[model samples]
Target: MLKYKILWFLFNLKASLASYRHEVHELGFQKGKKHLKVERIGYLPQQVNESSGLVYLAQDSTLLTHNDSGGAPYIYQIDLSGKLLNTYPISQAKNVDWEDISADEQGNLYIGDIGNNSHQRRDLCIYQVNKKIDAVLQKIPIHYPEKQTVPDAEAMFVAQGSIYVFTKNLDKSGTDLFVRKIGDNADTLQFKSHINLRTPITGAAINPQKNKFVLISYGKIYYFRIIEHQIDFSNPLYCLNFPHKQTESIAFLDENVVIITNEQGEIYRVCEN
Candidate 1:
């Protein structure tokens, strides 16, 4: 057990160092006008060190998050002050690289088990959990059409009865948007569009009104305006410099306020300046 813990520590350290280097390199490109005001709020509980997904529950006024791959299959609920409120366990599902979580209007939460860093996973799927019952409603299997080498993705959002997944694009070329409608069985993801951001996308969140959404990378945040109920990737509403380290999750506190969290358990709140 001690050996495993040591390996985990070393792995985290290596990842942190890489992220720091990327952040440093991005400093030169972020010299323009900063559009968002970011403030450190608090540190999350030690148990949530690798928080990977974030979503705000307006009805309960709480935030729900979960860890990344290799962590237990549990969702941690927390308050705005970064205090752990509760832990909900999903016994029906396995934590095969769970990357992001999204919620629909019908009180159902979608846990994306879609992280494919090796680009060789064939068992990718999404778990739909009914919040009220605290149980998984269905397991939606996902497949990439006409592609054997699947791209990794860590960001997802559910909008207008469909799930939108944005690829991380391990090559740092850009991100591709894929969509799969909510259904009773498995389906193939349809490639929708692409954004030329030249960075890996870590997390994404749509506002309560569903008119806008934001994608977060290690050192940048890209905001898009939803036009005619669709994501408009052509012209971003705002491309702000985030300058954070290993940020993996983001959610909207409201239409204007966004909450971001990294693997180091630091919490940051971003708002338009």
Candidate 2:
């Protein structure tokens, strides 16, 4: 049984017409259209960008943990069945600014609290959380920029034990990214290297097997072919029409398929065929 709110959202999102490209026009996409090979499994939804939502890929389980980016300071963790698991509060959780979470192989989680719209922040933070989810208040510590502040990043990806932050607001000065290596759980992650996109970046994705990486920006998703010694980011193997909506989250189900969910609860599966 679906909640009234979830059902209403699905009904409204699916009302939008099915088109490879959508105009500025507005339509609630109807669910019956695209042969949704994926299921509505669960939702970690935020009201617009007021909070963050997370869902595990293994099962349709959703963790209703949203950062209190406005009213409270708790990260409410819910099971995929939408059951409230636990609430971890952080005095550092900012209002309407906390973006997303990324996890490494060690079960450690990174909370990105750098969604600055004014682009004035000198230090961007990627908060670190121990693999033990129930770890307690103050169990996690946040790291911010020591010199330059990079803002408007809604995307984070884990690679080689480091957290990579991508900026949605690519400015003329050329957008740069951050690399932070995790240590002792709470110790300041060592800043490794900055990868200059030379252009603004929008989204990021790593394959399920942790073998490949893809970035979405300038209205396209480009794949990165990785070798032992070099990573080729020259071009995407194949590209699909960027969704009608400005997509935010990218989660891979396997090597050949991915489920890109829009903020409005619309999920699109990019099949590699």
Candidate 3:
């Protein structure tokens, strides 16, 4: 009987140790520690001199991008190799400072025309269009509450049925974040929070499945986790610096894969191993 009791004790001890080890592995993930690297994958077409924003279409394995204010009012379709496949023209909308493009899961694309460089534009809006066509469905007008001076922003993304804009504050203050419901009829957009990223943010993207969002500046990328519908800026989960001349756009190919583009038409792929 004593021999059987001893064997049972040994088995229970081994099980406990295994469970402890499993928990340690999970903790590492929660801390956002991982091996990752960024490499130049391709170059954009020479025509896309200022590739401002990028959105990946997983349904067809293609990318939709556009230039900034001075370019034509058209969307360029490209592949992973930066090869221009097609162009869709939005005749109804003017390309007045189109800084970012975001696509929802429901085949709708949102074009942000909210660039206020001089801080004097009272006509800030986002154009919603069909993903497969060149038709502008509707225009969502935005207003900064209690202030006539609107902030200049170049990065916007759609997630969880809401649109968010991150500012590129030149005043050296922290960046301001704004949120608006998808279909709400509010004249003034709701202010959510602020992120103290001192550098000017040029682009943003989200990895939905992993609950992670990335922000890009001139030569640096910042990662943050989304918690309770707000950006958790306690500290950046990860930060990376790469050789980018003028990085302006970012997109997620998957939870671990990221694609970035620069104003000079260079494309890079960042992967986590």
Candidate 4:
């Protein structure tokens, strides 16, 4: 049996890298949510934490804690509208080089802790919230994926009952996206494939239907349709970007729209026309 893989469909054209601008334009020839300005729940100045990676607008609210000067992109809980409800504290804050956060429909939240510099680290793993969440219980539990042999990647996507990882592919001409199913050393995930993104992808997310995907990077947002074969890295179907600090997470609120979150906890709602 052929191991089925997910691919994104591209629909638009042209590529120009220069200056940062914020404008909404529906690329013709093809098709495509909330109107409220993401009311600032509250913010920590950029100087607070020098580094930024992933932010899981985690489904659990009580698990969310407030800021601790110890480490990381401070974890927090916010309403769908982006209001700060609570924040989670980091106890040890060890190896939390978080790249992005992905959640299964079952409410299982996967935090991508693999952030590699120079692609040198050999040991990598994903932090699985092993603690079972009960409708009656209000505390957070900690769980982790066994271990992985895949290279460190800043991008992660939850799809087809597994997880997909992609690195920045920075300074190497076009981008390259790597795929791997989620598992551990005990029950390792099979290696899927490596894709040449040809685009600078900061982060990515799979839709609820798991039919399509969206990515944000290099100050632009791109969309893809799922295909049976490997992706063709030559062109993107549709792409757009705003003047933000390179987006990190792309969560789909619906088929025609999605949410792109920046490092500083800012979010953009893209509505296709």
Off by over 4 Å in 3: 1-34, 232-235
lDDT of 4: 0.47
| Cα error, candidate 3, residue 143 (Å) | 0.9
TM-score of each: 0.87, 0.61, 0.84, 0.63
Determine which window of 10 residues in candidate 1 has minimal summed lDDT: 23-32
Better of 2 and 3 by TM-score: 3
Which candidate's TM-score is highest?
1
Q: Whole-model Cα lDDT per candidate?
A: 0.82, 0.49, 0.77, 0.47
Q: Taking the tens digit of each residue's C-alpha lDDT, what string does model 1 give over 98-210?
A: 99999998879999999987788999999999976379999999888788698889999998999999998756567899999998354999989886665678899999888
Per candidate, the number of residue pairs that clash is 0, 13, 0, 14
Candidates sorted by TM-score, best first: 1, 3, 4, 2
Which has the higher lDDT value, candidate number 2 or candidate number 4? Answer: 2
lDDT (10s digit) by residue, model 2, range 65-116: 3442354645665443334566676565444456666566665666666666
Can you give the lDDT of residue 31 in candidate 3? 22
lDDT of 3 by residue, 70-127 (tens): 6888999999999999989999999889999998879899999988878888899999
**Highest lDDT against the true fold, candidate:** 1
RMSD of candidates 1 onward, in order? 4.7, 8.9, 16.0, 10.0
Cα distance off (Å), candidate 4, residue 25: 19
